[model samples]
Target: MTKPFDVKIGINPISWSNDDLPSLGGKTPLSVALAEGKAIGYQGFELGNKFPREPEALRAVLAGHGLELVSGWYSGRLARRSVEEEIEAVDTHLTLLAFNGAKVMVYGEVADSIQGTQEPLYKRPRFFHPEQWRDYADKLNAFAQHTLSRGVRVAYHHHMGAYVETPADVDRLMSLTSESVGLLFDSGHMTFAGGDAVAVLARHVGRVCHMHCKDVRPRVIRHARNRNWSFLESVINGAFTVPGDGSIDFRALIRLLYDNDYSGWLVVEAEQDPVVAPSYRYAEKGYRYLRDLVERVPLEAAREAA
Candidate 1:
């Protein structure tokens, strides 16, 4: 039967080897991660630190594992840099993504971000003035428009310790930016940021071009919140986990995506200590859970229609 929504399954390599915390799964090879993820039936993968930067080499490596390049994260300093400088910085990474058939580039605003640091999560940066938001959006609009012209769209990622961490922040950013600046709706981050993923998706479904199906442990998040832990500290304490292993309702999330006719990659991204969670095991679990949900959604839709 044909599916209700057009979607592809992908996984971020952070589960195998984290980019921010090198020591977490740092010893794991890129090849092993790719092979195991491909074996779990992931159709694509997001770029990781260890992945070859050369487009041709990256292509060959993914081709070997029968996986497509689903796009990668771009640390955007558009909040502080001019549009010209931001565009110049993204050139090489953008080329790699476009060459590998990725339609969207995951853009995370890292300017003044405490995500990679030991600063408490409560210490996340914020835009205190209206002009700050406007200036940042103007720069982002120009940059996203430029990238869209080059074939790949920019999907803004609302991260934990960045300026755009809260639901209100996402709403504000979406209101300020043009349609060219698509939203990268990440469920885990949304939940961790005290927002309902379903509600957020419903509100910005039109602007959402990519998705990160990340799940979080509520108890860990509560502990982090109570103790005022850093983003990295929370991650180390197992704040994130694969779908079917955490609190987020994937069935409801997928059903909403199907209802909205969402057509893009649903990337499974959960940063966890590989030694504690076991990368391949959690990868397989997440893959099977999402695969089942995706398959079941269409059947449920047809039944309802009948």
Candidate 2:
């Protein structure tokens, strides 16, 4: 048997957040995920951005569920904000995350838009730009500095829309960043965005701070490419799933992580499926599948090595 990395399964709120949308209550789905996470034997969770912003209240909810806060999503246009302003926001969120023993901050870059037309659409990821890379790097450096100053770590999430998604993009990010600013790799999104996790992790092993253990459906990938599906839309359309249940080769992926000495958490990020699949049933099935995959991954490595 192969040794294991210190990993924890988590759910992204986007899936469960929409559960009690308008007519229904909103908190039900999220509560379900937290409860199910603990009941099914997960050690920690990445609380979604849409959770109640009040840190104390959020802490209470987490305590009730028996889940440790592993990490969380935050938004801002680092290009426009001053470092101090960003630090303030980081401090606030970090306090909540820290209170629950979270060590990593999942940074989501959102373009702040006013009701006015001058501000750009915040939800979409902007196209890649070299200058933007430096600005992003600078922003991350500043945030990482501030986070560390507060005694926490920050992982820059190169998510689908917010400017860092490709292999080259991840390259630029790691090259520009200090080790304090680490990679939060999402296997499903990497492959979905034309990135090979196997290759990318090989290049930046030392800088990977955290991970998301989700996987993608190849048929959905085919549909996504053929139909020009947006990343979020595809996620909403049942394109992502549990690790072994999807097309990703978790054995190779985990082997790479093991070789890299990845001692951080393996967050389970399935944004859209939680709603379509429902939190209780979806999380229960996902937990068992991922746990099994985690257990089997190392044996594959030992077999190959032998």
Candidate 3:
């Protein structure tokens, strides 16, 4: 029987090539990543550094591998820039997503993010005043409204070193922003921040337009916290991995989405050393695990309905 919701499985190229730390899989070609991902049964892929910038070129490249363009990350500086300036900066990226038939765009607040730096996670910049939340949300509301007009929704990514990292921070942002600003729910980052991923999702599932099905190793996270490791340092130490390979309970997560009638791409994204976790092997494992979990949800839902 057909499922009641439309939940497509996709993967981010970060598992094969780390964008922030390019040296990890910098030698691997984009073609290889696409081919391997397609072989693993992912319906699509998120944008990566090696992807073609031109719309037509990128379309052709993905088409060749029988994959769709899920979405691409946009480093938004709305925390420090005007809504108009933010819109201007995102025009090309918005155009690419729209032209490629993508429905959502990943927007990560990078105005003061330290995820890319060697700084410790605890050293991340914080919102100094309460008014900062109102100001940032206003800008996000405007930006998201404009992007929706261009045929793509904005999914705000609350990253590890960004201003909005914890569950409380996410709650505040969601409360402040209009519904136009959707959330890109990431399981790994949420878990890494020491928040209950399921509980957080339960509170804000309605605003989830996209999701990153990333998993976290609790041991690595504990070590990182104990030793004051940077975000990248933790990633290098195998803090993140594909779902089912780590401690996350994807079955519960998928069931919740299905119960909520969620519809969008669930992307398997993990920034790990390709050498330690061979891309194809790990990617295939994640794909199969999520596929089974997603498929099982509808059956259970049907039984409940019956």
Best by lDDT: 1
**Candidate 1 stretches greater than 4 Å from native:** 1-3
Write model 3 residue lDDT over 1-306, tens digit each, in one string. 546768899999998999999889999999999999998899999999999999999999999999999999999999899999999999999999999999999999898899999999998878878898898888899989999999999999989998999999999999999999999999999999989999999999999999999999999999999999999999999999999999998888888888888999999999999999999999998999999988787888787777
**Candidate 1, position 76, lDDT:** 92
Q: Which stretches of candidate 2 lie over 4 Å from their true place?
A: 1-4, 19-29, 112-129, 273-276, 298-306
* Residue 8, model 3, lDDT: 94
**Residue 215 lDDT, candidate 3, scale 0-100:** 94
After superposing candidate 3 on the true structure, give the runs of residues whose Cα lies further than 4 Å from its correct spot.
1-3
Which stretch of 10 consecutive residues in model 2 shows the poorest summed lDDT? 112-121
Give each model a TM-score. Answer: 0.98, 0.84, 0.98
Worst 10 residues of 3 by lDDT: 1-10
lDDT tens digits by residue: candidate 2, 84-183: 7888766677887776677888876666322112222234455456787787787779778888776678777776655676688788888888888878
Q: Considering lDDT, where higher is better, how would the candidates rank from best to worst?
A: 1, 3, 2
In angstroms, the error of model 2 at 301 is: 4.9
